[model samples]
Target: MPSNVHSEEEWARLQPHITKLYSDEAKSLKEVMEAMERGYDFHATPRMYKHRLQKWGLDKKYKEKEVIHMSLLKKQREALGKRSIFFVRGKEVDWEQIEKYLHRRPDLKTKIRAGMLKMSSDSFDIVCRSPSPDPILHASNTLQYTDELLRLLDGYYVSSLSECPSGKRVNKVRDYAAAIRCFRRLDQARTMILANMLEPGFLALNKSLDDLKFVVRDQDATLIFYLCDVVTIFDQRHSPLVVELLRHTYGILQITFGESHPLVWLLRRLILLPEIDRYEVIATVVKAAVDKFERPGVDDRVIERLKCHYFLLLDHMASKGIKTTASFPEMDATSMDAVSVAYLGRFADRLVHSCKFEEAERKSDLMLPWLQNTANRQHAAWPDLQLFYLHVKAHGAFTRGDNKVGEAWLATVDQHAGRYFPNM
Candidate 1:
């Protein structure tokens, strides 16, 4: 076919071949055109190729600023003794290319290092609490709280270090210990909250009372607490104390780690949830963040996972009788990670709680294959998730007046319980 005289059917027929040549083989336009002409007697103009590539979202080239921003993020991650991999516009960035750009633009490198160049959403400002102490409290009292928190943090750090920690784990323990201590002081809590939401272990579905004992001294159920309890303090949203504590903790995280750090981004979303009252506002924030997520120096999977969590959050609000015109965000669980798969199970439960049993059953039904396929099925939490899903199915069946099906689901749940938790 002539280059300028191609039909829609011809382009459709050639799409796969052209895709393989250009995207899969990473061929230039000239090479792709030459190969197509030589091999398939197909011809296309460069303008057509460029338009198609853009339309297909297969364009691999980055703007100059994007390269510089990605390089800066790489440098920031490496300085924190972490490995950074970048994917922008659906293409993996070459490290050698970033290095070449940095070498040529020494001034840009200096400006990035000095935190002057604003490149992406990865750059965040630290928000500090007001300098003045609360009117009810004295400066000395505030200092006392800070001093006590530091002492506790130091003790935790020492004990954690004594456990034969090495490398990044030690640093993580240290950073989280400081963040925890800051959280305690900001919340004005005499007893320490055992759960740190920032800690990956807290995301486990199988944690029990025994797991929470390390955070508080008392065995009393009343004293053990999670970060959310501290943030909102039992339906006491929009309190000055909550606002102050959240801001202070946010600042502690931002200052301890730079803006582009993964922990900071995680903390940002965590803190954002409680501060914003409206679901619409929260959804907008999430959409914006997800839109810019490609170059935010954060993993795309992590961003999607967070979006799932935000959906769960909004669902929880609606279940609590909060009026909201905003629709919840939908997720494509087919390609989601383990965290997201687990969240889907929770979301199904939320649906059940909302009395949307049919939707709950459908979501729960979709979860089984994803659960089985995920690498997390090997973890201790797997059985717990299984049990939860089975119970959800049983509840949905019972709600729909199908006693036989409900009993069958319960029997399966019991079987799992017997196998996974014999003592219980």
Candidate 2:
């Protein structure tokens, strides 16, 4: 028999059977062409086959593909359960009957008994559906169900930091954290998982928190806060992870609430925890960055921006009379302050640029006490000279009734000009 040549009798006999097989499986015309080439026998009349295919919803181009292999069918049956149909070496086989012959694992048995898993006639039909009847409640309940599933899976899958490579564990933890974020129940999720993690897992959890800090949504603030609370609780027992988690959570809070936000107050308290060296290293690093780098486009600026943010938070706290032991030295022009007076002068310049005359004056006022204290007491030549010059210029400007000019002069003198003036 030639490939392209066929008798009318042969065509009439085979075409109908081919159409019936294609129609039974809902295969499209193109799929039918491909299947026939793959050895499907067509034996019925063409018209009857076409009518049957259309009646069975198999005539459309988009109809689902036919299952032609038993192995593929068996795998799907195991994953999706006994309701699947199988075609074993071109012969149709019942999936439910096959399951009866195979021994199931205890876990699989438990899932079947608990209804956590289900069987379906089609793979698509095995999808988890909402238990809620009401549309609004269904959406909420669906989220809750997803959260529980992740929580359950996390226990078995999320490895401890010590038990796995740091990179792999960190990635897993971050993925779990992200999953928790999606369902709006991160706090409950964290609480459920935190109870499972021992001391060693804290490091991985901290790394996960660090990774998630940037992606946290506003709705996750409570979760971030809850993580911070957990860190605080374990601060003494697990100083390193606690510190890292606190830092990460603080960063998240800063982004979500901005510097002047009250959440910063909570962060300040966390930063000042007793076991943590809040003032010595972390505060110093923050101060240096804010004073040096956190401006418009300096590439290495996150540390500095964070530092400046911390300073603004401190300023906000002071304005509200929140007595915090965490103190940073004021920047002065002539004194050996942590930051140079030249920088203070620049900061004052920015205040002037913003047309913040009063703010500029207050900044100068902040420097005044230091200058006045230095002037009235024993001081170094440079500081004394700077203080006297600042006083003279401030007084001269005040006398002239140009308060803004006076404030600018005061800021400059306190910051730089005083360094050139000799003590009078």
Candidate 3:
């Protein structure tokens, strides 16, 4: 069948005629459509015309008005579909009715199993209010039952990621992350939480990320690194259960270069996409048209945005008291380029501000040596890179009450001497 696409003028012309036939004369949609085709220049099919009516909000005006007619079956289905896990009936939930409904509609299982469906209240209080046997929902072992729920949830989250189609799973990954965020909140839903039982799979605390690496497709895989990297958000030895859970899932994400740690190696290929571009990898066709030639579009802004993102993550690490190492353990890894060095400089600079005198001094110590190596190789010493190296050292000196050392570095910055900053 041909497209029912009509020009604005044609649609404008047809509207009055359709309104009169359907509402004024009380003709059925099919009768109105037939009249339209016979009298007006309506070339589209009845289904297409009906679709247009719905799209344009015309059908609702002409729809036959009636009372709020919610039948018994409708009420049953609505209650069943409202929450993922609900009570059966009476004081306790009976699984029989809903279980039968789920048996008939397998699609609900697909959504729930894929982590798209979240639980309403973990547990709800349902009472029949009438004289029915008090069928309260009670488990033999509450702790064990909660553990089983967590395991079941964990299985769904993992399966959801695995089931996502490759090369088209951008939103799925983000949606899964959203699901993870919800799952993360579950630790606080109840006072008594089983830390060990709910962790590793359902909610990883500070475990190895070897399992979920395969689930990450495209740039979203980098989220796994962020999830596992050296994050000092909380001390591994936090006193509370909630803090401990946060500590494990978001590990200490310290930035370092070497194959010994997967950070730099992963960063090498993990394409840095801005939060707005989160779903870009899905496909251009899938998204509404993004003007390629628009001012400061994706191309003009990507690098700087990526730099900002790295700077923020690094700054966060320092603020959280995550220790930044003075040196990387020797290992073969992807060599740093100008761009990567710039990112490192930005990151180390944040450490200088967020850390104490000694810690900042140590960061400068590592940075200067690394920057020197990078500077010699690149033969490009712009002001930003030079400032990063000098500012940290000068701050360290000033904080240590070493006026002479601080003054010497300050003199070099003010004088702009060729030898002091040879590249400048």
Candidate 4:
């Protein structure tokens, strides 16, 4: 057995391997301890043993370079503003050189540096918390500084990734998310930032969505949903940023989760803005869905559910007095044809339920003419035709106060009712 004099060192040297062993094979710590004891060799010091392990790529040392760099950068920034003639090593210096020096530092001090970077307590408690802060002046200055910092950080992170694609250095995605959260908090700090034209905070939020998209598969869906909810609250209906963010979000959903994913429902809720370019966002989602599920034996239920969702979106638009256009900028003729058929079918069903026979007939006339104009249109079955006929007749009877005729029409509907509308 190895002597107990070096047991602590041995334990430290073996710590990483022991952790890996336990993780890779799900072994108990006690089992790892026993195994290490059984294979003990007493020729070297613990330091030597640790060096050997590290040399063999079996151990790693925790480093804090990023934290240290951030701290020095913040301190330099504060000093440049406070002291008129800042000097370093017998020469006067500027803030830019101080920042460059900090960035090039070998060791980072994370926590201390981050603390230094935080806004002063006096500023937070007095300037930000005051009920009557100069909204326009404060917002203009803060937004300018925040936007410059964000752009600089974005470039830095991108450069770092480009230099080493597989480099397991800093967690850039997590850091970006944190920065976005910081901007969001700042935006919430005052009403001034909310109404500002720069919209630095909202742009940061959109970048957050992009970062989330990059690592969404590894992130919790519930957390993403919550973040999206917060975004909706911040991005009121009139905000133009809402449309751009929704477009990015739609792309994220397409690559990370399929159309049937429940998170898509949350996204759908967020894009319920009347002033937003609805067709643009919806068309992106529809194209993604069609491309993802164009297999030979696709699930019929999934297709139907997607169609139902589009129908509901159209209904919502119509209710808001927004006209539905046949032309979408992003969709081709063939794609538009598929979407139109699905939308019209649902519209007809809704009219049937509302007992609007004349309206249903009018929509059918409008749709049939377009459907016929398409070069390679899909055929509608006789049963489908008869179903609409009976729905129209039922609506006519309901309007005329002929309960007997309405009942007779409903009996025919029952004979043809599928699983979806079984009770109806």
Reference-based TM-score of each model: 0.36, 0.19, 0.24, 0.23
The Cα error of candidate 1 at residue 40, in Å, is 99
lDDT of 2 by residue, 1-424 (tens): 3244446666555645454545435565566655665674433344544664454333322112222223234334433212334343344444443332122223443444344553444533222211221122233344343333334223322322214544543222121224222221222223223444332233334444544553444222123223333343332333444454566677776776577544444454545434423322233333332443334443332232233335433432332243345433354334423122322332343344335657555655554544456443343333433443354445445544789987897687556633443321
Per-residue lDDT tens digits for candidate 4, residues 1-424, read 5454555566567655554454334454455555666665434444654454444433111112322333444444322221123333343344454343334332322434445444333311111110221112233344343334334333432443335444332222221223223222322221223434233343344444545554444432123322333334333333444444554566677667676444454454435534333333333334343344444554443344344443444443454344554321121323333334434544554465456767666654544543455452333333333344455455556555889988998787667656323432
Which regions of candidate 4 deviate over 4 angstroms?
Answer: 1-315, 321-342, 349-359, 362-396, 399-402, 418-424
lDDT of 3 by residue, 1-424 (tens): 5356688788767776775576546688778867877786477777766776665544322111110111122233322222122322233434353443344335554554344454343333332222222122333433343343334333423443336566543222121232222212221121112222332222232222322232222334224323322222222233233223322232322222223233322222112222122112112211111121223423323333233333344344443343333232221114433333344444444455444665555544544544566444344443334554565566556556788998998776556535543532
lDDT (Cα, tens digit) per residue for candidate 1, span 120-218: 765333121223423243334444443443343334334433253344222221111222222222221211112222122221211332332333321
Which of candidates 2 and 3 is the stronger one according to TM-score? 3
Q: Regarding lDDT, does 1 or 2 come out ahead? A: 1
Q: Which stretches of candidate 1 lie over 4 Å from their true place?
A: 1-226, 229-295, 319-330, 374-377
How accurate locally, in lDDT, is each candidate? 0.50, 0.39, 0.38, 0.41
Judged by lDDT against the true structure, how good is candidate 3?
0.38
The window of 10 residues in a row where model 2 has the poorest summed lDDT is 125-134
